[model samples]
Target chain A: MGNVPAKESPPNSGGRSRSSTYSGSGGGPFGPNGSSSSARRNTTSSAYHQSGGFLNGIANANDKRSKKTEEKDRLHRKHLLGLIVRYTENVDGGYLAPFGTYKSNLDYNCDIVRGLIMKRRLAPFYTPLQDFDESWTNEELIVILNQLPLHSIETAYSNEEEEDDIDNHKIHKSTNFYRRQEQKAKLKELMLQMKQIQKEEENKYLEIKSSSSVGQRSVELSSNDLLLRLYRNATECPICFLYYPENMNISRCCLQPICTECFVQIKRLDAHPPHDEEHNSRTNNDSEDLPHTLISEPAHCPYCASSEFGVTYEPSLDICTGFGGIKPGKFRSVDESNDDAIASSSTSPSPVSPRKAVKPRRKSSLAINTPGVISIDMIRPDWEAKLASARNKLARKAATASAIHASNLIMNADEDSYSPSDSRRNVGSSALSNVEQRMIEEALRLSLLDEEERRAKERREERK
Target chain B: MAALPKRIIKETERLVSDPVPGITAIPSEENLRYFEVTIEGPSSSPYAEGEFKLELYLPDDYPMCAPKVRFLTRIYHPNIDKLGRICLDVLKDNWSPALQIRTVLLSIQALLGAPNPDDPLANDVAEDWKKDEKRAIEVAREWTAKYAVKS
Candidate 1:
């Protein structure tokens, strides 16, 4: 189901128009002129100055509020959550400790993960914690803060930045480099704002905690205990967009959360017949002489587009021994043996297998099997068949070419060496007699021409 | 024909609830996946003040596949062809699931603000754009007035 129901629009309409209006009062992160292209263009120069002033104003002016202030706070929290989401896009570890090896970036990544806890997408966060009390808990308010819509801000700020430069965009192609730098700086500023907001919420929570004695144990839990609980919390998988426990499968490249169901669905695109590009490019119009064996490219990470896409699943220790499954830091491709370990031990049967339930048509011709990784053959079930056919095509092309030339070169002996069976047998090995070697070389040359002809024919058919 | 994904529903809700400025996307009543959209041209561009209409349809594998978008209101531009097929990278190969309808529409709006004649989808328009940018922009403005202006 790719479509969103239009009927759902009306109910959420109450706070819909508040974004543009909110940006109006205290010049948005952009500025006084609001969304005019010129104001946005000037932002590129004094970016930090405007963001700092606007963010500080919102931070300081907390008490004397309007009804719009609540909505504005919601928008601010959502934007902060968005910054965290974007920050984690390239981070290398799981939810609790997302900063992988670069200890230098630990403080930076920690702030992002801390912000991630407030995401409504997280399983434990599904129910609004605010309904229980008028004076909401720190976490509850933080979650409420995370609930505003930033789709408009994202479009206005990021997309417009690119558009504004479309005239001289090429000259400023260093935009990506600058954007990364800007993100890091912006992330730093937002983290400080988050800390301030959390501090205020913490003050309120402390007052509530002091007044209430019954629920002391829950409120007084140590930060370490909270971390442990966070480890046990359910994370929403970015690919399948479903929630799962913290130990959900992690993509090898960017460590983005993915479920096992979606992990197995990742497969390589139709394996290019080996040397397809090189041979095609080498002899522009001639595809007849190239070899026809097909070797599949490894599937890439959907999040990062990192090739040879694979995932490592760490079992939650609380469920079982947790030591039974593949340990972290292992780069095993998702294979059958591991698949069983994963399937049998998955915390719960997935509510819906996204592959079977939603996207059954995304199957590719090749599975993810590469040599040396004895992992799950989840996608590349027919790799052997594909390789065999490629061998068959090579043998046939060799035999036909040898048959054409062998009789002219060395009568009976070469004809025997060039025989279909001999060519077929020798296609798999390199050891050959002098005359047979020459015949095969000649055959290979002719085979390249044959491959070119076949491809050209296919191209013509494709065009038609 | 399948039930709508939650992602689409959420995206739809936000697209309406917190709509992008100068851009409005309303899902069709008949088919939840189909949306009627209008992007007001950027203020400084040839398409300024023009409310260009576009039809957006999410295929079975949206976010995996890009939403199928085409211009409904015609105007002169280099990157948009006569059939309303837009020649933008994000609309085709560069699409990521992270991108949403708002981003795509914003991109279209941006494309209008800055048409790259070098990468022309409408060859004759692009040629004219390169030969005489002033005249080409004038024609774009004329087309905007003639066809894209909403009654």
Candidate 2:
């Protein structure tokens, strides 16, 4: 009975190992070419190297057995990759599905929508501030849906590939040509299933609308009036304590409401500093340190503490995206429909401007690439670079201060460029005090060094 | 200091209006971030009769990070050190933004009722509690009477 020994392949080990690359100055700055896929590839190669070494350790293993074992390992690897692809699609689909669509697919979407509307809870295209559950005429639901941006629903379809597409890219990179073709075919099939489900949900929605007697009587309010009502009954974001319209961005993990302003501000702190093990092993004894590239941890949901903090936003149905039909920086008047809202959505530029008057919701910009969800990292794009530069500036200041004090005898050429007065000015109000403090410390350190050198010379002479 | 965030103001209002049953937290006039807190130890514990004082300060990144809380009243519990620093998960890694000051104070009161010797801040106290349970309880009671008692 020749049993294939299980290969210890942990998925998160890649994330853990890749932490140092982005974490600080150690792995250097992530240039334009350096992305997550390249980092992931490094992990795959390292995994292969480990297995190769394991195989080498078996001294008496015959070539036939080794080749057979390799075949088994390849199959095992293929199985693992398949699981990853399926898992990514499931999670992404689950998030993309309209809130409550997961209960029983397309069948219960209406019930979930009704339940959500009754609760006066925010959902994609179903944000109702006041409960009209008893008076929830099918016409009212249609009116509400029509008024709010139903175009954002189409935005989800475009984003369907999002993370799964990225996973497929990874799968393509990891596998052989045949495996790549196989995985691509499998992904196409999965995508078709998703599309079919989406179509069924749309059909269900149409059927619901056709059955309703919406045509018999005219809907009372215009889109603008509905927007005004939603504004009047705005929900306050807990973090910023600011009142936003009913169609506020919903936290992906806990479904708690958050305004775009506060949601973007929630960033991951650098919890894990860059480890020097890889750097030390790769380089010879060079005293100079590698520049640390700041890697940010995924922000946790403020309400739930669930990691990979992200938000799902459904664009508000009116002239401007929801939250009282107001953008964060630009406050638009209810009646005034201008180009300012479009200009203000500078964070996320969407080619498909649903309406010329409607300013796309900030998250809708992200909706194309990420689909339904926008992670904190995407919310504050290039945050890692900003953080790294900020840390570097602080480190440079500290380095100059220490260099001025410590290396009085052997000053580097760069020391000439550093002016104490310049640094003092940068230090602001405490400049004079800081200079005085540094001067005193410098004097003390110099005197101590001179004294130590003289004592060492005398000791040397005595030994001779 | 920048103007207080509205969330803090709102939280403070709620904390004052609906004060926790056995816990009271009053913000200082000069620094609203700093609070003077007192917790009446849980009933049926060694600290039942004692009134424990604690100082809690919310950092700039409040809610994102846990509040820095320290005991002003010395506690003789395995989880509490002589300096009154507590070894509690909520005060550290297990803290969630969903948790409020009210919830945290409630947790502290609950901690008094149950002293976890397995994870201790004060090693000697934990050892003493583990080795001789009755003696440890008596000592805790004596310390509570000596230090935590309100004159």
Candidate 3:
């Protein structure tokens, strides 16, 4: 058979000369019978020489293949190194996003490394390649790399490109457009996430609020958290120094929120002293007459009471008392009884003027022994009269006791030096001791005779 | 978020952990760039026994720029005004990148010990110091005893 003869021809000498001729003239074209002719030449050549020719062809093809592979490996290494350097150095003058590039490059390198490991090719350079997971395949790594946006990689390259000439401006502009679009997409995604989180927080707050009692609701309403937030958001109403909600009667001209009391003042500026009859009549026909009537007078602000006023329109019912003469319930006249009491109390006393009644009480205590001494007479007259009567009795008793004690002491003195006549003379000395001794003795004898005659006459009349 | 200036973050960390003696700086947690500091007066000066508080703020470009330092605790130094604003060359014109928080604090302590009366922030205090050193020192000591002492 032809196959048997061809198989045996490899051991012949004819094939050696044909193979030599073919090598000497590189890649010559053969005729249609070339296969048969070549097989016949191949059979003539010895088996050793034929085997040598086959070895030479295999070696030549391997050399070309190895050279091409080495060139490709060098290029891949250069690219990988460039990526590492750019990411590590952040070579975009600090403006570029190295993180994105790093992630992408990491994914790409992982694929290449993973492919080499799976094929057992990495064993030569990385000895433990067999231990790595086979599931970490190249295709999986490539998917991860593709997931990273293209603009990010372009950004890495553009940073280097910026150092080049202005002639590259068109390319730079196009890259910037792509970068902006990528940034916008990223920003939108972030915003959506943030909104979701905010919504969750708000729902949580609502849940807490709903579970609470009315008392708790009031407590929550008045809590410092809410009050502080309101205060921060609300500028002080220029009129009252208190915060007015934005829904209140804010002055359009000044952009200031005014209290209802101040809002009245602002609305009445045009109506001061009453407008002309013609103008009043024309404006009075409006159905909202309550606001106009209440705002007729340019009233003083209860707070500052400044007469200077301006105009305000679009006053809300909650904030303004009189809007188109429709008086809100909050603006009714305040009760003046408490105010009157306060005014009276404040005006009643002056530090400079002494109180008349208080002065008398102090003076009477100081002048206790003098007439009008006890205005205790004024406070309690009966008690004062009884006290005075008791004092008179005390004085009489003191006089009698003092007189009796004096007589007892005098009586106890020496009897011989104290004659009865001498005592009598002493008692009568003031009236009769101016004359001589005989005249004093005759006067004493006559005064004794007259006293005895009077006594005898009174005794005879009593016996009859 | 705007990226934190790396230089400021690094320097601030160092300043907090390894602070200068007689100076204590504590930045607000809510506002990392604003700091409150307390400086103890140096010994051998009229201001001794004093502990003055200061407010410092790192601007956005800090490290590239110096921080703004003000005396919140009133001081009687010639270089500090009644409003508690301090006038120091290092804070304004003579700032250098090499200078850090520790160095600035030391400079402030030195300023208190040896005031620059010729270039004064509080003119009255400076005038008193120039006219009568003893009186100025007495007043400074009195202020220290009254206002700055811990007790």
Candidate 4:
């Protein structure tokens, strides 16, 4: 993922060798005058001279040269084989050809060769010679000896050409063999790379699809669970008059999902109350003579049967606690009335109890007997008022914040304009969002209005 | 299917345990990747007393990406369109792995409280907000009263 440093060679500094020849028409081995070839030859000869008397002079020199040439040929073949291996590896590693044009397999082989040579030049041994100029002379000689193999390799290839004519068919067969092997390796690598890329893409696609699917599944499961819990709680949908199923349309309120149809019905009933003309007339007539009752009753569930039958009162704990600490016989049901009387007798006060006790009991009875009042209509208006006030407060806060944000943006813009650096300009250019900029402008206008209003108020106060 | 990203799972759990006050969210039992949420309007905003529903779905690479959230309930805010789509940076380019459902919902609630007309999803709302904020706010309040309020 990081950049790899490129390798380069220093310029060669020796004169050209007149003996150097090129079969193909081109410039010198290292440009005009064959400077590189002469330099290399000199370096090798010096190295040979340094190893004096190690062999039988002239004859040994020729023999050594021939042997080295043969070795060079072998090494060249090995290098070619290595290049083939690397090409195949790169293909398998998912390297793709450049867009627009198709590169021949031979081109790939050439690239491998170039890469190897470039790497070799970057070796530590080829470090700059300026710091060790004195030793570099000798080092240069060794380098020349090291490069002698390149010359021999070229010579070996030429020698093979002369013999190639006699064994033309065999030579072709061998070349074909090498080509096939190289091609096979490259093909395998290409297949591997293709598979790897395909797999990666496939995985990415699956991830996106599965995530949404999982989310959907989770929603369904939770809905089902909610339905089950509601069923277990013994709550039924009023509209269907049936227990909730795993799948059904449900609207939630207070952690409960009611059927939408039932909810609509409840809303409708709560919004409108039917008036009974006879009951109203009777109540109007009694209102003048009867004492006003301060106590209000709790509202019963609208959907309950008792609500429709005019039998809405329920004997709740609040009723018991409020009235004289709940007298034993007082509010007993018909079935328990006899038992209640007996219990009352056991807990009855002594006959000798004073008038004070009787007074307190009467006060407590009045308090308890008077049920707490709840008016659906009254609660609704109070809630509406609260909601309105809250909305107003939020609007005020939003206006203030928006003003501050606008001022900050203006300040930033001013700063940006004053700054001269190109980097700062780049930063500002990127910061601007067309939509956001427009919104800010609107917010600024609002801020200005608020500011004007505040200023006007201040002026009036000062005058006062 | 690839396993859910660890960051997303952690964020989801956090959102569930310490949900935004007005927002009630629950992961689906059948699949832990999806969430159903109900958000109550903040008392101080024009949306007060309004209840809005939303759906959130996590992608496989959720933490590295972003959850897909869409309003199921109709709303009238500069950043929220009639189609229920929202235009917020956190849901787009500004998305960071650190953001969670709680933060997202909170951001959305904040957005309702103070719509960014500058980055609106609804062009008409933005134009009205720019030309006459009072009218824009009135429209928003009207929508809340008509469509969002539970009553």
Candidate 5:
């Protein structure tokens, strides 16, 4: 009787090789133009490439094969096919899942996932000294990893395909009839809009150039502007990493613009007496912002580590787009900003006077007095206020599901009874859970409402 | 997350444009947080004339927290252990958010110049240095030549 050889289970390395055959279908005969159908064709070609193994020879042998042997061989092939399918399905899931949060269809919290990570951790190469039960599971590692601000993994499958999209613009050069027309039209429209914006900007610039008292004064002004722009473009604040448009505070040690805002913050941190012992504590408490990294300071410069760097504010702060900004030398001294306003008022022929900024914060005019005294207020930074702001930011970022649930319950509270938001007024301690924070906020709201209602009742009695 | 804080990017850019003397730091292509660093020992120190390889990793909360740094090259120093871990104030409790990559590396270079045996990570080396300073220096110089020199 002719007997077929029994097939063994494929090991991991063999499984990997088998799964890679999925990509083999990508470069098939039918897809001259790349399409999903080409991948399907590739799969068929790959299957065709694998000619029947020793089984065919065994079947062709000039002896009648026992019915039981034939049945066993058929069942073995079907089982092997099922295993291959499972392996391929997993490979596909890994490639398709969004990076970080690899939320596949499979239940991550299930025992199967726990078993898998356990197996990985138990491997001989893994750390041998760790307390096994206390250590984080693979699921926890994945969750924390996903929480980290990082990008998706570049799977071999997807990365190769994205490169294809770049050349999807083949229609612009080749005028290929097969290429989608709507996409090309959208691209053309986008290009036209960009050109239009460029043209408008050029025209506006020309008008400004023409209107600026043509000839000698204009040339002088333009040269001044060029120098200012060069300086502004080259110099960026070392602390904030923003270009110096205004209020440049150059450190005496490094001579780099460290920005007044950052310096002020540094000064505030300096004022907070150093908490020496807390540095080593690994507690997950947010209130202390995970223990301050700094110890004692005549607070050193971050760049040079020099304690002697005195901050010198630039004379003409850069043109500040907002509060705490200064675009220097753009109008001469800080005082020139106001003068330019006056100059424009005198020369401009337009009927509509440009609305002057209301509640302007920085008066470049005030900056004329150099080496302003470092008042106690300036040197002794407000540590509490800074901490409050920092605490609020942490609370916002760390909001969990429970916190939202608590907030939702508070939503049921009568809006009429709700007083002004006390949540906005004060920052809670970092140790409070999101749920606790929401509850505190609701309580604060209720108390405020009570006060308002009492005041309203008093007014009604007086009117009666 | 929040795009690598602008301050970090600025620090990295300046590192490339105007590299520090006797030191070089290049960020890894895969992860910007990881840096492959090379520092030349100070001329005055026992580590002088030797090039040290170090791996520096900026954590997610860098600037707010101290960078994780480990020496790759073997050396004989009181403050540095066999595991390549360093015992320095600036890299630990004394760290400030104000400190950057340049400042931290400078602090490490300074640590090499002034090996404080009293506050040492390698206890055995520290004991040797305290007992016989001259003999300890000899061992350090030998190790520098043996392990640190490329040739």
Candidate 6:
């Protein structure tokens, strides 16, 4: 079932439209006018500015309100429990104090949570705190994760079936070990503590969910999605519209993100600017003969078109690669072991069991002891016909688009139109899952019936 | 070309199951990547009480890039040109992979309400909008009534 609550009324007709009314407010963090705000902010002593001072007083009052809001935010975070951290290198064995107790590394002016989180001061924060951004060298994160006795430092969890399998249980046990006795002892204690924390978080999630008003507002905090729960706010980068990569780089130009790999890719595109310019100038000429000066042009922000850009901060370590960094066994189960869900689904049938287990017990069980037992002959003919039909459709679309798009650009169907027929091979796997085979058969039979229906219609016309 | 990603399938399913109010986007029978969409003009805008049709296509590199969309029905707006191409930022520069078909449509609907004459796709329409705001709005109402009638 979908995570959303059961529809009381048709969700399609839900009062979402009212909520979607255009606020006319933009998302720029600076101000309403964006870049233009800075220029207006510079005006200090104009003739009209004397009266503007009166307006400034009102602005100061608004600032006081914002300050109150900030204080309220701090109070909210202060209640949350923090780790009592101690530096192992201390000669006198200093007291295990709150992370804020260390004034140098932490920004004491900010609240404990922000100081520990925003500054990326992970060495002192040992309570399995929030996830840090991708740019943090990943070295400190390693130390912090190691100290986290609760979550396993190895063995990343994945989506279902593997946990249920009897064979994997032994493998999981064999991998559990420690290099030192002190570490071993800590693991058991941490495991108990983590279980308690998980229970508390579960309760918190439910408490929030039960309150219908809070449910909509606190979706990120309430969500069990690894990145969502960790970040507690932003995840999707504004520039690429994708989740920020592990080493996330924020462009200072417009405060939008250029995800790590995308940043690198964008730079590569900017690297051959001279060649590109030359290509444009040369018309039909290839770029091979251009004088290559390795001096790359400054890359512009895709959204803002500003050339001044650099990595200001990392948002979060590469979250897209299926919670790959966090050990699977560490944090409590979320929706599913998300890491290898796609990989496992595609390759569900255990290759080793194929030769040994001949009997088909479940409907999904494959019957195979010998090679080539299940031949492709059954579905091949139908697949070929489907491909042929798809090709015909593609050709017709291509001809239409090309003819009409020359001037009156109704469609800009690129010459390299994506052919759905080409994907048949990918779906027609040799190691066909039992479910997949049945689906193919059902489709083949359905197509045959459709063909008969058409033939009958033709025969009826002849009789008439 | 690779097979259509699961993201496309998921987006299509959600569009059908939990459709945006006053908006319907159905994949064409001929091409699943192509969508035939209809949006009722938002109230309080010049385009109100009008049903406008649109053509939206998810190119192969969709989500990474913006979906190719244009108004099929003629519209008289400063931001939308004669060919019905809109000058919305998200449709070009600000396109993010996180945005789905639903969000894009919502943005377009919003654009109808707040026409940015300063940055216009239809220069002549924008000039008309600037010179005579009342007459421009009247023309818009007329165009919506004539060309954007619900089929």
The most accurate candidate by DockQ is 5
Encode model 5's per-residue lDDT on A406-448: one tens digit a residue: 4545443434334577752232322234434554453333334
lDDT of 1 by residue, B10-123 (tens): 689878889899999998786677788899999999899899988787654565557778787887999887767787877754565657888899999999988988777778
Candidate 4 per-residue lDDT, tens place, A415-440, comes to 75766778766656555443245444
Instruction: Return whichever of 2 and 5 wins on DockQ.
Output: 5
Q: Which docking band does candidate 1 fall into? A: incorrect
Model 3 stretches with alpha carbons more than 4 Å out: A1-464, B1-3
**Displacement of the residue B119 alpha carbon in candidate 5, Å:** 2.9
* Better candidate by TM-score, 3 or 6: 6
The 10-residue segment of model 3 chain A with minimum total lDDT is: A123-132
Query: Where is model 6 more than 4 Å wrong at Cα?
Result: A1-464
Q: What is the C-alpha RMSD of each candidate to the true structure, in Å?
A: 27.7, 25.0, 57.0, 41.3, 29.1, 31.8
| Sort by lDDT, top down from the best | 2, 1, 5, 6, 3, 4
C-alpha DockQ of every model: 0.02, 0.07, 0.03, 0.03, 0.16, 0.01
lDDT of 1 by residue, A45-77 (tens): 232232344435434434432433344455555
| Candidate 5 chain B lowest-lDDT run of ten | B1-10
Ranking by TM-score: 2, 1, 5, 6, 3, 4
Best by TM-score: 2
Q: Model 1 Cα displacement at A67 (Å)?
A: 74
**In model 3, how many backbone clashes occur?**
17
| TM-score for chain A in each prediction | 0.25, 0.28, 0.16, 0.17, 0.23, 0.19
Docking outcome class, model 5: incorrect
Model 6 chain B weakest lDDT span, ten residues long: B1-10
